[model samples]
Target: MTNEQKALITATVPVLKENGVLLTKHFYNRMFTHNPELKNMFNMGNQQSGRQQTALAMAVLAYAENIANPSVLIPVVDRIGQKHVSLDIRPEHYIIVGKHLIASIQEVLGDAATPEIVAAWTVAYNQLAGLMAGHETNLYEQQTHKTNGWTGWRPFKVGKKTPESAEITSFYLYPADGGKVAPHQPGQFISIRLFLPQLNLKQARQYSVSSTPGHEYYRISVKREKGANLDTNGMISNQLHDFINENDVVDLTAPAGNFTLAPDIDAPVTLISGGVGITPLLSMLNSLVENDYTHPITWLHGCRDQSVHAFRNQLNDIVKTKDNVKQHVFYNQVTDENREAGVLEGYLDISKVPSLNLQPNAHYFICGPSAFIQKQYHDLVGAGVNKQHIYFEEFGPQLLSLN
Candidate 1:
C-alpha cells in the first residue's frame, strides 16, 4: 500500500483494538446470513464460546499494530496456516472472508468509517490474506506430496472405539479403500470432518493422534465435552462419542501441526499433562518408550482422580518397566486407595513436587487447559528451563502467549 494508505491503517489501530470483537462478531453473522453454505467450514462450538470472535479480533488488532512490519506476524501466520491446511481452507475462502470483514468494518463504524479508511483496509486485508493464503498453499503442497498423504479429505472407517476413561474414548481409524496412511509426527493432529445431523451441517475438529506411528491404523482419543456451551460441549465430540460407531465413515485431512517432540533424545525430557490433554503426549510418551528415549524421562500427570485418569494401567506399566521413566500422579480428589498406591492429593504443583527439581538440558512439553498450560510454562521457565525448550498445546484457539 502507498504511504497514505499505510498511515490510514495505522490510524485505525485504536479502532481495531476497541471494536475488533464487535466487528468480527458482526462479520461472522453477516457472512453466515449472506452465505449460509460457509457455515460448514467453521467451528460453531468456538463461535458459541466466543473464542473464534476473540481470536479473530486479536489477530486483526495485531495485524493493524504491525502494519509497517508485516514480517513480524510471520510466525503467527505460519501457526495459523498449518491449521488452515488441516481444515482444507482454500485460497478462495479468503475472498469471502475479506469481503465480509471490510463490509463489517464500514457497517460497525458508520459515518466515522470514511471511504478512504475503508479503501486502506481493503489493501491491508488483501496483504494479510495474501500472506496467509500463500503459507497455507505451501502447507497443502507439503501434505499432498508426502508419501501416502492426500489433500482435502479422504474417507476413513472407524475400526474400533475403546473407552479410555469416563470422559475419553479412543477411535481407531483405517482407510476405507485399504490404502496406506501417512505417518504423522508424535504430537501432530489431523482434522476430522463429520456431518452433524442435528444441525444439518458439517463440522471439522482437530484431534491429536494418540497412538504411536507406524501402525496400520491412526488412533485419536476424544474427550466427550459436556456443559452448556455448545461451542465447547459442541456437536463434533458428542457425535464421535454417541453416534459414530465401528465401521462408520468419516473424512480426514492429512496430519498437520507444529507441536511435536524436539529431536534431542539426550535432553532430559519432561512430559506433563492434565485431563484429556494427555492425548498427544500419549503418542510422544509411547514413542519415547519404544525408542528407549536416551534421557531421564519424567512423566507427571494431574487429574480429578483415578476414575478419570485414562490409560492408568498402561502408564503404570511404562513406569514399572522403563528405568528412565519416573512419575508423579496428582489427584484433586484422592481416596485412601490412591494414597496406598503413592498418588498425591490435590492439583498439580510444580514448586511443591520434589520431582520438579531442575535438570540439566531439560525440555518440557505441556498440554492442558490454557490456564494450566500457562502455569506449567511459567513454572518451568522459573525453574531455569530455557524458554526455547518449552512446548505446549492448548485445546481451543491458541490465544495464550508462551513468552
Candidate 2:
C-alpha cells in the first residue's frame, strides 16, 4: 500500500476504535433503511442484543490491524465466509454493505473525512470486499459441487433421538432425499440452520458429528443448555431439545471444521474432552476403531455426572471390544448408585495428562465450552505439547476476555 494509504488507515484506526459502535449503528441503520430487504439477512435479535454491533466493530478493527499484511487475515475471512454461506449471504449484499459503510464513515467523520481519507477507505473496503466476494464464491461453489454432497441446506431427517442422559440427547440424522452422503473426517462439524417461527428469522449453529464417517447417517450429541443459575439458556440448543423430534427435517450444511484427527496412525493419540465436548472426540475414536488404526488411543472425558455423560454404552462397548482403546471417565458430583466405581471424580487436571503414557509425537484434540477449552489449551501448552499437534473446537466465540 502507498504511504498515503497507510497514513489514512492509521488515522482511521483511532477514529474507529473511538466511535466504532456509532459507525456500526449508523451503517446498519442506513443500510437497512435504504434496503429494507437486508433486514432479513441479519440477525435482528443479535443486533438488538449488541452482538452484531460487537461483531462489526471487531471485523473492522481486525481489518485495520491486518491492513499492511492482508494474508494474515485469510483464516478470519474464511470463517466469515462460512458464516455468510450458512446465512445465504451473497456478493451483491457485500456491495450494499460497502456503500453503507463508506457513507457512514463520511457522515460520522464530517470535515475529517478528506478526499485522501475517502480514497483510502474506498480502496481498503474494495480490497476487503473483493476478498470476501471471492472467498464466498469459492465456498458457494464448493457447497454446490455435486461430487461434494455439500450443496446448500440438505434435508436430514431425525432418524433417532436417544436420550443418553438427563441433560444430553444423541440425534441420528439421515438424508431425507436418500442421496449418498459425503464421508467426513473425524472431528469435523456440520452447520445446522433452523427457522425460528417465533422470531421469523433464521439461526445457525455448528455441531460436531458424534458418529464415525462411514455411517449412512450423521449423529450429533447435544447437551441441553439450561441456564446456569441466572444465566440465559442457549437459544439454539434449547430449541433443538424442546421442539425437535423424530422424523423432523433439519437443514444441514456439509461438515466443515479445522480440527481433525491426523491421518497418520503411527503416533499415539490422546483425546481429552469435557462435557459435551466429547462429541467430536467420539467421532475420532469411532473412526479409529472402525478403520482398525492400530495406534494406541487414550480417551479421557470429564462430565458433571454419569447422568449427563453421553454415549456411555457405546464408549464402553468400544473399550471392551478394542484392545487398543483405553477409557478414563472423570465424573463431578456423581450421585447415582448404579454408577461405576473407581472412576476419577473431579475436573480434569492438566498434570494428569502427561502421565497417560503418550509418546512425544502423539496428537491431542480438545473441545468444550470456551473456558474449559482455553484452560486445556493453556495446560497442554504448559505440558510441552507441540502447538501444531494440539487442536480444539470451541462451542462459542473465543473472544479475548476483557476482565
In TM-score terms, which candidate is top?
A: 1
CA-lDDT, candidates in order: 0.88, 0.78
Q: For candidate 1, lDDT tens digit of each residue in 1-403?
A: 9989989989998888888889999999999999999889888878887899999999998888889999998879988888888888999999999999999999999998999999999999999999999988888888777878788999999999999999999999999999888888899999999888777888889999999887377999998877764563367898899999999999998888989986565678889999988989999999999987768888889999898999999999999999988889899999999999989888887776775656735878999989899888888877888887888988767788776
Listed per candidate, the RMSD to the true structure in angstroms reads 1.5, 3.5
TM-score, predicted candidate 2 vs. hidden true structure: 0.86
* Candidate 2 worst ten-residue window by lDDT: 394-403
Tens digit of per-residue lDDT, candidate 2, span 223-324: 787654311225667778889999999988787665788676568888989998999998898888878988889888888888788888888898999998
TM-score of each: 0.96, 0.86
| lDDT at position 170, candidate 1 | 98
